[model samples]
Target: MKRSNRLVALTNYFLENPRLHKQLPYFVNRLETTKASVSEDMDIIDAVFRNEGLGYLQRTTGAGGGVKYIPEYLHEKSEAFIHEMCHQLADPVRILPGGYLYMSDLLGNPKTVREIGRVFASAFSQMEIDVVVTVATKGIPLAYSVASFLDVPVVIVRRDPKVTEGSSVSINYVSGSSRKIQTMVLPKRSLEEGANVCIIDDFMKAGGTITGMINLLEEFNAQVKAIGVLAEADDEEEERVVENYTSLIKISNVDLKAKSIEVHPGNFVEIGDRK
Candidate 1:
């Protein structure tokens, strides 16, 4: 293939397969090009990736060394997106009953979700997460998107047991926002022992659900490497349960009577370089 054609294929391959390692000879043979040519192509791609703040190519030269993409959504870009989301979320139209938000439209947008995933994936890129975990329903898409960029698998925790999944480990925990006891179930085979886990969720209110998920993960000896939420309720009246979490936006105040809402960037911006 021509150098230009080869470059396009190489870029697509790395983007589609993040963190996938292969020897230089593997690419040279696949592209029907010489080692020196492939090296030059990689250098060009690497420079562009870095300059564009997309990610960097991690290249190693030894016997087991190879190049892989480590997608890091630039901190500045992440901050800008967070601010834009905050502005949109502050709209009074987003206020729902009981001070909840109407964020389904945003969550349903593939582009938005992918962008959110990239931000979270970038924040947690340094962690060696084996799987992206989330509760069933809303969080599934976000989890899959993050896993896509991280080149990891996703494990979901469900509210009810599925007999088809065989024996499951279930735990009852109190909901952070509702303050009601709820049960969460996970299949025994869902996660391997001692797997590093990153939890993703759509929203957090007092972080009860996330805390519950964390407790449940302990049953399988899974390590919680990171926690990310799209939005978090910032109600001082309610005591926060989960710390060490990254949130994209904060709903500071939602007044039902006034039909107004307040939002801002999450804690991730304040706490620099959590990695």
Candidate 2:
């Protein structure tokens, strides 16, 4: 293969699977080129990535370190990829009784979760998103996956206060569906003033929990660049508060009697230009 094509292939490989970049030898073995040639190609790829404003290609120099690409590449390809996945998640059969949709399997599957995380991270790639925030315990994995892609930190919002979190600020917000009051708390110093935060969650029933997160972000004087949910329960009434947020899938309804479910992509993908 030509040197230029090799570089592109190498960079794409790293973008597709970041963990492999941690082992230099493994990444090197994948190529039929010399170590010196590989190093030079990586440098060229990194420059191309930066020049294009796609983000940065990070290289850690250590015994176990390898090369990884932090996607700065904003392209139509990325949007198409995300939209296709969103459509898959729109299956009605995935829904359960009581207006609930099953997403634990998707969350536990690293490939799916990583793709979902990348889609969100790419959306906020240009923003100064210092942290990825989510409420426990289902949202933790999504948060972590996004943080990894964004190369940022993940902060957890605990339902119950813990001594480890030190002093926390708590708030009570109305549930979007249940209409019952639910509480969400965050550590007082978890975020800095003027920090940009991207909130992620596994699912949305009433959007009450997300609103609570918004309120918490406000308390710290932080800015919410965007909100992402794995799936949203579709009820025109309950979805009012979440009109501004983004979701991978929308569950229109779950009819237990008929054993029918409905799902579709949210507005985020349709409107996201990511320019």
Candidate 3:
């Protein structure tokens, strides 16, 4: 095939199978090309990917030589998208009761969710994550999106376990924002013991829900490798229990009486976690 056609096909394959390693011979046979030509193509693709602020191809040599694609979102893209989020969230119309901002619309948009997934996946790209875990409902989509880029499965912690899911582990904890007791469950088969886990959530207020998830993962002896949040309520009155988390946006102030809201970039940008 021509180099133009080969590049398109190779790019699509890399995107479809992120982090999947394949031998040079495999592509050489499939593309009907010489080893040197295949290597040149990879160099070109890697250069373009890095230039576009996507990600680069990781190539290994020797007996186990192969290549894998890493979908890392660039800092510039992440900051630009987060600023747009701040603008969208600044509208007073998003303010909800109890000084919480309505984010269901943004979370529901596939494109928006995918963008969030890219930013989060980029931030946690360096971790050796076994599974992406999230509570049922709002966080499910985000978890799946991140898992897709990571090439890992998603384990959902639900409010209640279904009979179809077989046996489960359950725990009760206090809600961070509401300060009410709540229960979350995960099926016994959903996660293996001592697995490396990356926790993803839609939003956090005082980090009660995230703390609960961490406590539950302990039962399985799972190590929490990383935590990613789409938005966090920066309520000064409530002391946050969970630290060491990456957030895409920070909602600092929400005034119901004045019909005004304040939104800013989250710790993800402040700390420069992504390259």
lDDT of 2 by residue, 21-105 (tens): 4655664677776777888888887787778655566788867766777775354555565567656665666666566766777
Off by over 4 Å in 2: 1-40, 43-69, 72-93, 273-275
* Worst 10 contiguous positions by lDDT, candidate 1: 266-275
> 175-271, model 1: which lDDT tens digit per residue?
9878799999999998999999999999999999999999999999999999999889999999999999999888877889989888988888887
Model 1 compared with the native: what TM-score?
A: 0.97
TM-score of each: 0.97, 0.73, 0.97
Candidate 3 lDDT:
0.93
Per-model C-alpha RMSD: 1.2, 6.7, 1.3
lDDT for position 239 in model 3: 95
TM-score of 3: 0.97
Rank order by lDDT, top first?
Answer: 3, 1, 2
lDDT of 3 at 39: 92
- Give the least accurate 10-residue stretch of model 2, judged by summed lDDT: 18-27
How accurate locally is residue 55 in candidate 3, as Cα lDDT from 0 to 100?
A: 93
RMSD (CA, Å), candidate 2 to true, equals 6.7
